[model samples]
Target: MQLTGMFVHPLKSTRGIAFERAFAGKLGLLHDREWLLVTPDGDQITARSHPQLVRVRVELLPGGILLHYEGKPPIFAMTTVFTRPHRAQVWKDVFQAWHGDQRLDAWFAAILGQECRLLWLGAQSGRALKGGGEKMSFADGYPFLLVNQASLDDLNSQLAQPVTLRHFRPNLVVNGDYPWMEDEWQVIRIGEVEFDVMKPCARCVLTTVNPDSGEKNPDGEPLRTLVRTRRLEEGVCFGINLKARNEGMLQLGAPLEILEQRYSF
Candidate 1:
């Protein structure tokens, strides 16, 4: 199999930037899910809870980041260092995240109509997933999730409207044989690096958004399909959540091989 597309989400739940090549970090991909919008209570806001967040588009520029959403003027923020008063919980661990900029937050709050805060994952965060003898930085849950083009094609064939791979929000997109084949992949090797497929990523409401247009649609379309067809004992299987067994840079167009077909964990 070969890598087809790669993406990095500079901020969680916002539009992701497609890349030809990206550095793989403990967190998954560089600048992927490294920033997030949160409420005053430090709860992370996602398209699941706040569908309007889908309207937010994030672009990483040379000097700073740009955010544009429907019905609002674009906002730009420099990549300056701003510290949070206290550590906040994104998922399980309390992480020290920097708020992007006050003005940007104010603008978003005007739309969100709640006291919202922005948090950027920093180098000093020292946050990681705990358990299962695996480690991950700041991804929603898994370090890396990979999907295949054939899988999306298969799903699209069942739907009236075809969905793009962006609907799945995977870090790695590959072209391969069977639909949802990556779900059975236990270990895959790219270049000299090896990765352990830890789990099947569970489908969520985020899949309902059209990433390019940031429009929300009925979750039933995809979620219902996945539940009926791809449901596993663990969750609705779609892609494989991977943890690096050996770290290395995964270049674009790198050939991927399934080194092992089964793993206990």
Candidate 2:
């Protein structure tokens, strides 16, 4: 198999940026979901609860980030050094976030009718995964999420409407494979990088949203079909969450070889 597409979500639940090659970090891709939007009490807010956040567009430039949203003029923040820690929350998890000195919290609160804050994941943070396995980073659960192109094609074929990969929010999308073939893959080697397939990425309501518009469609279309065809004890099966076995750079179009294929449902 081979990597067909790569994406990085700089801020969780806002928007993501596509890339050709990306540095593999403990948290899947570098700068992916490193930042999050939260409330004053550190509760994480996402498009699952707030669909309007889909309108918030983020672009990572050489210096800093450019944020564009409805009713607000484009805001630019420099990539200068961060001093004070930005206070924020992610769901029930509370952590210190690094943020630019812009009035982002106030602006977001005013627009959303609640107290909201923008938080950036700092390189110095010691957040790690809690499972009894190799250390991982802040990625909701696993380090990396990968999907096969053929699986998407199969799902698209079943739907009356077309859905893009963005609906699934995978870190890596690989081609040259059949639907659910990745489930049997144990270890995947891409170029010099090696990753162990840890677990299956369960489906969620986020899969129903159009990543571009942040609009939530009827859930029954895809999720219902998946439940009937690919449902496990937890949820519908789609991709595999991977943990880095050996660290190395991942370039675009790199050949992927499955070292082990002993996975079972």
Candidate 3:
């Protein structure tokens, strides 16, 4: 299978930045989800609650970030230094994170129409990978989420109105594999990097949200279909979460090799 798409959400649940080539690291591609937004109480905020976050554009810059939203000039913040520690909770893990500043906080607050602040994933972020000992960035769970094109085609065949790939928010998309081939893949190599296939990525209502308009499907599609087709005791799964075994470069059109395989389901 060859890698056909590479995406990075510089900010979680926001617009993704497509990359032709990226430097793979322990957490993921260098800038993937290195920053995030959180409520003043230190709770994480994402598109699940405010789908409008999809309209926020994030551009990774050296030691800073550039945020663009419609009808206003882009806002830029340099994070060379951090403020006092702010606790951020994701799933079951909690870690101390650095808040940008009042100006940065106010910028996102206006965009989100709520009291929210930006948090930088710095030395304070120590969320451990599920199986691996390495730390991670602001990603919800794992470093990488991979999807197979064939699997999406199979799912689309069942949908009345097929959705695009963005709604699923995969970090990498590969072709030339059978539908759901990643489900059984234990280890794979993309370009020069090796990754351990950790677990299946579960689907949720977030899948029903339109990636472009922030509109949600009232019928709860793909997620509903997946429940009937791909459900397990855990949840409805679409992609496989990956933990990089070794850091290297990953690029579009790179051939992926199944270095090892162990059928689980």
Candidate 4:
């Protein structure tokens, strides 16, 4: 098995940027989900609710980020070097994050047609994993979410219209021997980083949103299909959540070594 793709979402819930190589931090891929969108009251807003957010393309820049949307000039938001710590929420985790200035707020509000604030996770994060000691950023739950290409291919073969990895929003994509082969993996090393296979990632309505158009599928595909085929006690499942045991650089085509297998194949 080998690493086939890597991606990072500088801003949570927006389009992700594919990379040939990425720095894996203890928290997550560098710059992955470092920024988040929230209601003025600190409630998180994601593509699951605001589907149009998927239309916003975020390009990470050295100092900050560039936001691109149709019919509008690209908006550049520089990283806030200094700011008062603002409180925000992601699921049940509430912690202090930095506000990205008023200019950025206005631009995002105009694009999304809703009042919202952008929060930065800051250089040091305070939210620790639920049962583990490692820190994490604004990702849904785990630091990394990995998907198998063969698994997606298998899912595609069952669908009338195929879905892409964009819908699943994985941080890493690997190709291995067969479909769902990653399910049995307990610990795996990609490039120089080793990750613990955390749990099966549950699928949600977000998977029904088209990354390109930001439109919810009228037919409710992949998600519906998953419910029929991959449903578990935890709801429909698709990918596996992972947490890195160590930090290093991950590159495309790096051999994936399964260090431990906890389940019988």
- The numbered model that scores best in lDDT is 4
lDDT-based ranking, best first? 4, 3, 1, 2
RMSD of each: 2.6, 2.6, 1.6, 1.2
Off by over 4 Å in 2: 78-82, 85-94, 99-102, 132-138
Q: What stretches of model 1 exceed 4 Å from their correct place?
A: 62-64, 132-135, 263-265
lDDT of 3 by residue, 27-137 (tens): 887888888899888888999989988988888887788998888788886777666688887777788888757887887888789999788887545577665567988
lDDT value, candidate 2, whole model: 0.74
Query: Which run of 10 residues does model 2 get worst, by summed lDDT?
Result: 129-138
lDDT of candidate model 4 versus the reference: 0.89
| Model 1 TM-score relative to the real fold | 0.90
Candidate 4: stretches off by over 4 Å:
none
Please report how far candidate 2 places residue 63 from its true position, in Å: 4.8
Model 2, C-alpha of 132: deviation from truth (Å): 5.5
TM-scores of the models, in the given order? 0.90, 0.89, 0.95, 0.97
Q: Which candidate leads in TM-score?
A: 4
lDDT of 4 by residue, 1-265 (tens): 8999999998998999999999998888999998899999888889998898899999888888889989888988777652767888999998888885887888889977899998888889868777977788999999999999999999999999999999999999999789988888999999889999988999899999999999999999988889999987666899899998888999999999999997765
Compose the digit string of candidate 1's lDDT tens values, residues 30-52.
77776778887777877777767
> Which window of 10 residues has the lowest lDDT sum in candidate 3?
123-132
Clashes of 1: 0
Ranking by TM-score: 4, 3, 1, 2
| Clash pairs (backbone) in predicted model 3 | none
